[model samples]
Target: MIEADDNENVERLRRIEAVTDAALSRLDTEDLLDELLDRVRDLMRVDTAAIMLLDPHSQHLVATAAKGLEEEIRRNLRIPVGSGFAGRVARTGQPVVIENVGENDVVSPVLRDTGIRSLLGVPMLAGPDLVGVLHVGTLQPRHFTPDDVQLLQLVADRAGLASQARLTMIDRTAALALQRSLLPTRLPEVPGVDLAARYVPGHEAGIGGDWYDVFTLPSGWLGMVVGDVSGHGLQAAVVMGRLRSALRAYALECDNPADALTRLDRKIQHFETGNLATVLYAMISPDREWIRVSLAGHLPPVTASPGCPAELMSLPVDPPLGIGAVQVRHSTVVAFPPDAVLVGYTDGLVERRGELIDIGLDRLRAATQPDDAETVCAVIMTALAPERPADDIALVGIRRQTPAG
Candidate 1:
């Protein structure tokens, strides 16, 4: 005959393993917590279980998920960092087990209404920082054990890791979706601009730092920008979003192309990143009389017109933003004749393997000859055929329309 206590102990250990395994299986926090709270009720022999997560502001712990609490209480409850038992556990990074909650001062009066007599709470900590708390409360006046607190704490630690991972995934997904939406849905129909643009996410699973935007400026000038931050993945995507939004705002507010970029760089300095970004900004007007171009550590743009063999615009500018302090010069305005074409691209287009960068540039320049803007884009994409692009590529081609006789 087996003792009741021994059998219960074995069952509790089995439930602990199950909860930990379930939490580890999920990379997302919300899913992990859902599984965790369900398993906690089973493991602790409790009526209900809940998981609270620290808000970004860190002022209060919100009930992110619950297994058995009423919809009304669960929806409305937010425990301040030092208000209840769970709050104390979060603030002090300690585990608390109340054998008799009716005698305890920290147990929330709200839980009393739920008829809970015994409660256990554990801080969910990542390293030394506390993330939130996990708790289970029972209706019967039960004797909670040290092993019970330890088991919940182990689960809480796993919950912290899951939460942080999910938070990062959410942030990257939001920024990438917003970035894609902000980019031109379809290339604008400009008289002389042949634009072929492609945005490739980095080798990693999340969003890439590369982006391009083409739109009409206030003064009937066509604007184009292609840029790449130094690193790949989420951090870069965040900075890219900010830079892209600021550029659009500045372009509307400023008069000159260089001034827009200069203001953009200054606005972004508030948030520091080791990653540097290379940008090429240009404005083209319909009159076919002039083109304003500027470069900041980006590949020099190629301009080719009939009778004028392709030439690279190699104006010197400061290194990419975040390399160090930078000062931008006035944009160089070139005399554009009728039916001229200009192609602008990121370094990735030129840095493909199996051929030198110069070879790629020559190939691209060769494809830019006596064609309309759309045909020019198709020709270059064909030249770089098979589409095995390792790095992100963005290209914009602008051509000036010939005036009617």
Candidate 2:
């Protein structure tokens, strides 16, 4: 028979090996917990085991992985901080072992249902903060020795690493969903114009700094704008969102296209990182007889009316916002016959894999030709979309009202 001392040593070594293996596996949190619970059950000779992670916002301990526990109980169970025995361990950032958990007020009946009479739980910590709990339970009344506590503590460390990884992934996914939900589902219908919009984020699915929006003003003018924040990812997305919102508010409240952009710059400066962005705004009348367009360090859109050849239209730009406020010129032009399509785009559409801004603008000018609004937008995207886009791409197209049919 193995001596009691030798048995303890063997168990300790086995736990050390388990933790070492877990660290090397780099398994994501879900799989890591499965392995952890399996190791805990074998080492402690327990009937059941589980790992619970605390929801940062809810402050509730919810089990994420388990063995030998009722699926329903594990799914629905959540203990508030300091509510039950496990909760107290999480609250205190310590370990606790109860020999008769069935009789302990701190033990929930959900746990006792598994015939669990003994319980041991330790905090899973990432840095100094308690992230979750690592727990083992036995059906029969028994004592958890000091060595058992130490072994479980080691496992708790592994759980902490896994918890951090899982939470990060979850957060990024939710942020992306929120950003995508905020994007326009379809372009607005302009009576005389065909509209199409596209947004392509980087490989990470993060909100790219690019954005586009179109809305009809009460004055029967179709308000349009496109802007690009200086960088990429969530920060850029936030700036893009703020710019779009502020522009909408300004467009609805003010009729002057230049003044609307000026208001948008002031609002955006308050929230944007570095208070910087390149923007283009235009107000088109319902009859498409005139357009009042303004630029703030943004790419001027391409214009081509029916029966006319395509050409790039350049507008004077106020330097990008947040750098410093400069006088925005009033270079509003009237379209002859009021029947041209206006395309607004970010620099991503024209910039090459490694090239200068002027080069991209030059390419864009070269590419423009008299074509349908949708065709023009599609062609620009196809021409500018990189083999592997390093940044977000956004575009909006509008055409003046054509006479019936």
Candidate 3:
């Protein structure tokens, strides 16, 4: 004969373990969330159940999954951490229950509109990181007990991992597709100029901000670009894409490399606020005798000429995009002697853990010599790139044809 309280406790225990069910873990990353949210609503007997995940860039919790509160997800509900009910749960990293809800208690209007009266929320943790907040709401007033809070937390802990994995997987797939489609498949042929490039994603950070671009202007000037946005995952990749496109458009309009970068900086500061990135733009003359370059907080490119040792180019520096002003941008011209080779790359090529980045840069300089573009790319990649890097790397090489060419 089981007592009523014993039966209730047993039910709670059963629901808690259900979160770790083997079959539940095997479900598809995306479907996992919807299924979990449904089970949560049923288990808690709540009118609404929703999951809000952190948006690292904006420092807000964005509604990702919901049951009964479907409109919230559609509206892309965002709650700043430390502001309201869910925000308080995320900030305190604890369970919160409100027997009676009010307009003053939450930042999202969806809750008030839904007429939700009682709410119980818990922090969704993936190891030590506060990945999100999971909360249940009821239209009728209810006093949530300790046992109820614990049960919701159990569900939230598992939901955190599933939601994080699903979002990361989706973002990574989209980023890879964008990179493959954006990067040039075959280097263009320019009568006396040879070009080659290489790109590799980091093992730890995965697909990130590193990118390279090459194109010929209608004015017969050759444009080369290399840039690295500061951050990782899909957000960084998307920002990189926008900057790349914007720079290309600006390149068409601004004849000078400095003017192009100045415009790029202004665009980033105006539209993509709070993001930072380094970029280098180089424009070679039609005759291949001179190259004008603008660098914004980027490492200098290495140049090697026939019968001469490779060395880093000297250029005036400005703050990275999103930080620099139009007046701060400047361009410098360098002699592009016949048969000279120039290689531009992201910091990932030369930066290493615990070791001075100068060492890697010096190694790259020593490895390169006046050679064909393909040879220069091969040598630099072979000499510097690791089997599994800590950050993404992008490299591009250019060589002017000699008399023999």
Candidate 4:
């Protein structure tokens, strides 16, 4: 037999779980948060209920959703961790109860201004991490019981899991969409050049910043790029897009790959400080007889010709972009005869954990026989990539076609 309080807690738990049930999973994150807050206020019989999510980067709690006290959200209230009642709960990862809330008990005066006389707050935890803070308040003086604290903690737990999942999903979906938009939909049709590229995102946190591009310059030269930014998720993807655009714009003004990369390095070092990346930029001659290339801490491309084995091209490698040191960039010319194939790629294609990278490189070298661009791209991906890769892979294959074959 359950006590009256225990019965009420069970009822409250049931109601709270209803909002986050699978049937309601279709609601957008914001809508779900709003609905959760509504249920919290009604179930707890509080005058105001609100949620403050932690911005780990800032180490501050930001007002995300509110009920009965809309000013908290409207004003974008922020509370430093450990500074006040809500902050204390977040910092300690424990429930905080203020029997009679005072002006100084909170960082923001909005609680006092709204005449919230009592507050019951709990830390929203996703595993050991404090994802945010959840609290409810009332204008009337009331003693919040342990039962109340337990029930609210349960609410925080549910909300914490949902919020983390929804936010991660949003970031992953946005990053993938942005990357696809930046990559070429169809390789440009150059009379003497055959091009095909492949990009596979890792199944990690969000998405990795791996990109490849091919375009024709005003001088009728072919511009080829394969680069990888150093981090995962949407932020890295955004940085990759900026670098791609800046390189293309610089390519228009500069005469050679080294000159364009030098300008790009200056821009990145000045503007995108702390962001590091490896970039390989090349321009095939209009006659398709040779390719001029520059590398920034990037792997050299592999070249293979008719009845010949593939080998990695050796060239002077410079420091990666945003190194913040004085450096020199150099371009090397490689002989590219008709029917020869060249492959440019990011490191992810030939790097496997617990295995020497030289072995992967040798395997890739063995697989790249003189073949059509599409076939080469497909073969390399199959030969080098794992069933579940740990990093993003970007590859581009270019072949100069021969009239006979």
Candidate 5:
């Protein structure tokens, strides 16, 4: 009989571990917590189970996931720290067991209505930090054994780690979506030019402020831009979006790339005081014969003619935006022969840790030979970007189409 009981205990542990693994695999916090609560309720043979997470702003434990409870109670429950059963567990970082809920004054009236007679609450802790609380309840008054408390604590520990992981993933996903939304969804078709642009956020970095834009100007010219903001993650992305909008507004008002960048510099100096960014702005003429380019502490554009290898075009460099209150920005016009491609990219394309920038530039120049804009962009990214890049990359390529025979 003792051997049979040991086997049963091992199987139960395996089931609990399986449920915990499943919960950790989910990226969505709501779905993960819901699954965790359901599994805990089933595994413990309890009438109901719920999970609560502390709201940083409210300083209260809010019901994040619940099972076998009324929808109103599940959605509207909020227990302040040190107040109710769940709150006490969260505040004290310890487990609480009540043999009879009717005798406990700390039980909320709303929770009492659920017909719960016995309850056990454990702190969901991530190391030394209190993440939230996990609770299990029974319909009839019953004493919880020490083994039951230990099993519930094990689940709570896993829940804490899983919750943190889910929140991190959700934040990363949201930031990435916001960053992509700010970029040009579709490149406008120019009369005699083929344009292709790509943005790749760093694998380990979540998201960064790398962006590219192509739009038709009021004078029938095409405006191209590639930029990198000063930092990574959500703040950098926000600044990138603001700068992109401001640059577009400036580009629409001026015919020259230098003048547009000049205005953009003032806009940044006045509005975004501490933030800084590198920008490469170019205005391609309507005939596609020439491109007027301006660089703001950004890499010079690369060009490749038919039957020739790619080479970087040396252009005048200016201070990056948000540097000085008054700045003198300059532009240089380069000949854009038919069947030639012009490439603009952020530093991430060519810069790697402990390596000279010249090496990246040489690699980029060598990769840009006599290809369509799409092919050139793909080839450069595939060649330069590691499986998990350390910085965000943005590439914009434009090719003057060859006239049909």
Candidate 6:
């Protein structure tokens, strides 16, 4: 009988470990906690199981997931540090076993009312930090053995790691959404011009400060801008939005691309200190015969005429925005013949680790330059970014439509 009992205990622990592994594999934090609680309750033959996660800002343990507990109790429960059973375990970063909760003053009235006579609580530790608490309760008075405590602690460790990853993913997802919201949802339609744009986020970082915009100016000229702010994540995205708005306002007031960029540079220098961004702005005339381009420490724009290969235009480059008020900027005018295509893009399109920028530029020039704006955009993206790129990419292309006979 002794041997049989020992075998049974070992099998129960094996099952618990298996379920813990499954829970850790879940992507959603809440779902993983819920599954963990359910598995704990069943594997330990306990009446109830729950997981309480610490709110970093509030420093309170909130019940995130639970099994076999009243919905009202689970939703309304908040345990402060060093207070209740779970709180004490979280505060001390150790396991606590109660043979009889009714006799313990630390047990909350709500928990006592649920007929939980005995309980076991363990801290979920991720390295040196205490992430949360995991607890199980029984209706009848029962003693929790050392083996039970050890098994629960192991499960808690796994849960803590999974929770941390889930939180990081949630933060990235929110940042990406904000970045997308700030970008232009659709390009404005310009007469005699076909427009196409693409924004591709990096695989690892998820979002960065790459932006593109196309709009019609007051003088019936089509205005286009492509820019890249230094750095990645939410802060860079906020700076990009501010710069984009300021450039649009300046572009509307000034006819020359260089003048608008100069004003934008001054605005950035005065307001956003230490923030630098490279930008290329172009203004296309209403007749679609000429385009004025200006560069602020950015890559030169590319032009492709009918029956000719795509070539990068040579233009004088100035300092990027937010440098200072002294840097001089200038504009270069180029003839845009019929059935010509002009493209502006961020560095992500032509940048690779451990390679020269000229190599990427050569690849970009070799890409198929179709007459249709959308086709050219698709072809460039396919040729340059076939997989998850290491950096964010922003591309804007304008093709002059051939006049109908």
lDDT of 3 by residue, 309-396 (tens): 8999988887888874657688999999999999999999999999998899899999888889999899899999998999999999
- For each candidate, give its TM-score against the true structure: 0.70, 0.63, 0.84, 0.88, 0.67, 0.66
Name the top lDDT candidate.
3
Ranking by lDDT: 3, 4, 6, 5, 2, 1
What stretches of model 2 exceed 4 Å from their correct place? Answer: 1-13, 20-168, 271-275, 305-309, 324-331, 334-339
Candidate 2's error at 371, in angstroms?
2.4
Q: Which regions of candidate 1 fall more than 4 Å away from where they truly are?
A: 1-13, 16-32, 56-60, 67-119, 122-132, 138-146, 153-169, 203-205, 228-245, 270-278, 304-312, 319-328, 335-340, 347-393, 401-405
Candidate 6 Cα deviation (angstroms), residue 209 = 2.8
Whichever of 2 and 5 has more lDDT, that candidate is 5
Best model number under TM-score: 4
Kindly list the per-residue Cα lDDT of model 1 for residues 122-201, writing each as its tens digit: 88877777777888888887787877887888888888877866776777788678667766788877665455565555
Reference-based lDDT, each prediction: 0.73, 0.75, 0.89, 0.88, 0.84, 0.84
Measured on C-alpha atoms, candidate 5 has an lDDT of 0.84
Q: How accurate is candidate 2 locally (lDDT)?
A: 0.75
* Residues 91-136, model 6: lDDT tens digits: 8888999897755645555577677888999998778887788888
Error of 6 at 73 (Å): 12
* Model 5 C-alpha lDDT per residue in residues 301-392, reported as the tens digit of each score: 99999877788998888888888864478999999999999999989889888999999999999888767889988998888877778889
Clashes (N, CA, C under 3 Å) per candidate: 3, 2, 0, 0, 0, 0
lDDT of 4 by residue, 1-405 (tens): 469889877886686566557755678768877887887787778999889999987999999998987898889999899998989998888888887988788777788678888999999988988899999999998899876787788778878888888777878999999999999999999978888999888875458788999999999999999999989988899999999999999999987999999999898889888899899999999889989999999999999998888999989988899887745789999899878899999888899889998998999999898789999999999999888878998999999988665
Model 3 per-residue lDDT at 251 = 95
